[model samples]
Target: MIPTKLIPRTAEASEPPLLIKSLLAQSLKYEPQREIVYRDLFRMNYVEFNQRVRRLANVLAELGVKPGDTVAVLDWDSHRYLECFFGVTSAGAILHTVNVRLSPAQILYTMNHAEDKVVLIHEDFLPILTAIKDQLTTVDKFVVLSDKVYGETAPDVLSGIADYFSGEYEALLKEASSDYDFPDFDENTWATTFYTTGTTGNPKGVYFSHRQLFMHTMGLLTYIIGYEAMPFKGSTDVYMPITPMFHVHAWGFPFLATMMSAKQVYPGRYEPELLLKLLIKEGVTLSHCVPTILNMLVSSPAAQKFRDNLSRWKVLIGGSALTKGLAQAATDLGITVMSGYGMSETAPVMAVGYLNEQEQQLPKEDQLELRTRAGRISPFIEMRLMDDEGNFVPHDGHSLGEIVARGPWLTQGYYNDPERGAELWKGGWLHTGDVASISPDYWVMIADRTKDVIKTGGEWVSSLDMENILSQVEGVAESAVIGLPDARWGERPHALIVQKPGYNLTAEAIKSGLKDQVERGELHKWYVPDRILFVPEIPKTSVGKIDKKRIRSEMKEQILTS
Candidate 1:
């Protein structure tokens, strides 16, 4: 039997499990006249919002979508994408969100892997989809979600065996049933599937069940209110999900925004300047984004304009490590910045670095430092770090090991790949394959990926430590460390550097930074990178993590051609 404690009956629980359905009901019940605003469109209230979601679901069914059928959406963050996220999942269909940033082949591969029955595509991506239509196998229909209505094509642009409809999403929803008796969906039913953009291999698809999502939604609700001894969420809080919905439900902000009745905004396409403008104009109280994105935004010339706006903004950083420099900048600007960590497979929120009971009384600077570290394990999660021998590592924040986790919201396996699924679920635990150290306080600090860990002269070196230290150097914009092939030591550390604009970086300076580490005994003399190569910029994966694979590929090409 499922623990009642696991699924608490809060005031939010009185509503239906059809999350969109409940959201619609809430808007009508508490604030019938309150605005549910989007870019260029305002959903007047729950009444109008519910009707549209219902119609969209009906239109999807009319276009041949069935329960369990995957309906892929490819678009920037927008109200249309948000509507479809709820409408598709509400209809007992799996919402497969494609990362539009991926190349044509990668996008096609993900769609085919999901066996998407219909593609509710953005009009902007039509040309690209048209180009690859010949290769897609399972797509039976194409419903082009447009802000404006358009007529049928005079000429055949796509050679796919499917009908196309270019319909205004809002109008189509007017034609759908406002009161949909949603199918009694089993909690174990698949709700969504997405591919993880792992730096090493082809993206692996991970899916979530309805029950898992329900639990995730609850966890998000708990997180927003700081239920696990976090900063209390206020009703006046304004939310801007700079993170796209395609990225783990925008880290569950969309659901929480509606549940908490906060003003919700989506940056149609993330531009740092535009984001700052919105933050200033909209008086956004909270936002979530990666450290890199924040770094770029705060460094922009226009950032000065939002100086006072920054004071009211509370930000959460994820995707990659949140460095002390970036955190200090945000803190100095009065931005309440905290680091959070999760993988795509874990519904993307295993832990948030909010103050607990003991942390609450600490001085501001002390609290800020704690906020930078991955906080204690969340209520719903159980985490452990283990070595290859299955021995548990000490939580003294010094010993590094692999992070493995299991929880209600954690994914069980990849969509169809059994071999990888077994590896991911080895020992009945979802292995993160990320090397990290946990403190006695239960704070988790990721050192580097297990595959990226460097070995030199029979000793291990942390690539993340080297990269972090390198980033502190003047004239260095970004840096990456990787284990390169070496005859004597099996693998040696290699450095890839992106110099600041108008600056020239030398290998000598990077070696100098490590020379101190060598003297201090933090690193051995031979563990330093033998060569440093400067690049135009660091390549990033779809979700914005540094793509070391691309660096290795370019280096290999340069070597072979030379």
Candidate 2:
């Protein structure tokens, strides 16, 4: 450690700080001519992209945005949101990526909580804004982002809020000069913030600094480029992000793609047919999304229509675990599917299930094993599991413990909430709250969230493990397993399974299949759920992970009473 007396020296000559703007600047230098495509409606090369970014910055400055001011945006994964990522932050203001999927009450809370001074709304989301219009206290200006899929004309839907609207995104940029000096600031200043998907109560805020996001971008690139076998190709690959742009900056792909000058396609308000069309038409090679979105794509008629185009695509599944059944379906379609693990608290890319050279040589059937685990932890993240008593959980491939991580890119804490923040950063590690184990070779496999583990007769069983197995049942479309109260055993599992159309899977048939797997030693007798219910659909959170909390509350008495 250095001497304390020398630590506070602003006079230090060699302190080279990292900046987020550097990512854009570096991209502009080399691939300024690379294409940035927006759903066939808008297209621009990096040189023009830079001009748009600067113009957006000038517009914000004209609207009285200053350093440290919070500018919030409510839009889909579009080119405009991409501009805000750089322009707002480059101008030294904080970008609040508001989750438009939240209830109107939640949206009102988040905007006011962030004290957002300016709001950028997509024309589609205008009604949502007006519905909560009077409740918005901190928003001073609203810039409407056009939602025209294939036209230059703005939507006429803003008449309801004409008094609330400030200007249109295109017109404002057109009026502003493309020359504004974005002053450099300490990279530790806040850059972006968004609320967690929030299963429990009110949504909590998570934030990242410029340095943190830049470091995350570097960490992500380190593995994506370093691991040549990563599902998504680098630089030359066509990139699309099915994850909402407001969700962890679409897991930071926009920044990484911009930095690489990769061809980017933004499919606004993702429709299965439209996304499939763009996937083939634009030759999109890589994208990331939750499993539900992928399930939607593969289940659509568009998938069959564009079957030949599926082989060229690669997808990273996160926000929830990827089921083996889903992996098999993707494999059959010739789409490369892999699992990734992280939370909203992480700059959200911690690990990706990528095979190494040796592992890649294995048969395709065996490779799916590697493709389904939480995956190898990415570069620069220190991860390990700890037991219930806070002792080290040995990496023996069987011991389970809560997954915790420490990294340069991990959030410092929940923004402005010190109590939860301290708990999150407890024991000097950013507690991931996910339970997982590591193989001897260091491949990480997340079993379940800490709270979701099932305990029966003093034995811990993974709820995720059961759901993963049940998902493979022929007629099952999706599954959710929850440990319910049992007087005989502490808690036994109850499962809710959604069936595919034209298939009626009875509870006995499902149990019989599970029993066969148990006999084959693939599952434990206790691991078999005590009860299974076929449902039309399983409830899901906003970002499309299973909503067990809601299910447990809704079905507990019925299951117990039965």
lDDT of 2: 0.86
Lowest-lDDT window of 10 residues in candidate 2? 227-236
Colliding residue pairs in candidate 2 = none
Kindly list the per-residue Cα lDDT of model 2 for residues 279-338, writing each as its tens digit.
Answer: 998889999999889988988877887888898788999988898999998888999988
Consecutive 10-residue window with the lowest summed lDDT within model 1? 152-161
TM-score for each predicted model, relative to the true structure: 0.88, 0.96
Please report how far candidate 2 places residue 83 from its true position, in Å: 0.4
Q: Which candidate is the best by lDDT?
A: 2
RMSD (Å) of each candidate, 1 decimal: 4.4, 2.2
lDDT by candidate, in order shown:
0.75, 0.86
lDDT (Cα, 0-100) at 205 in candidate 2: 90
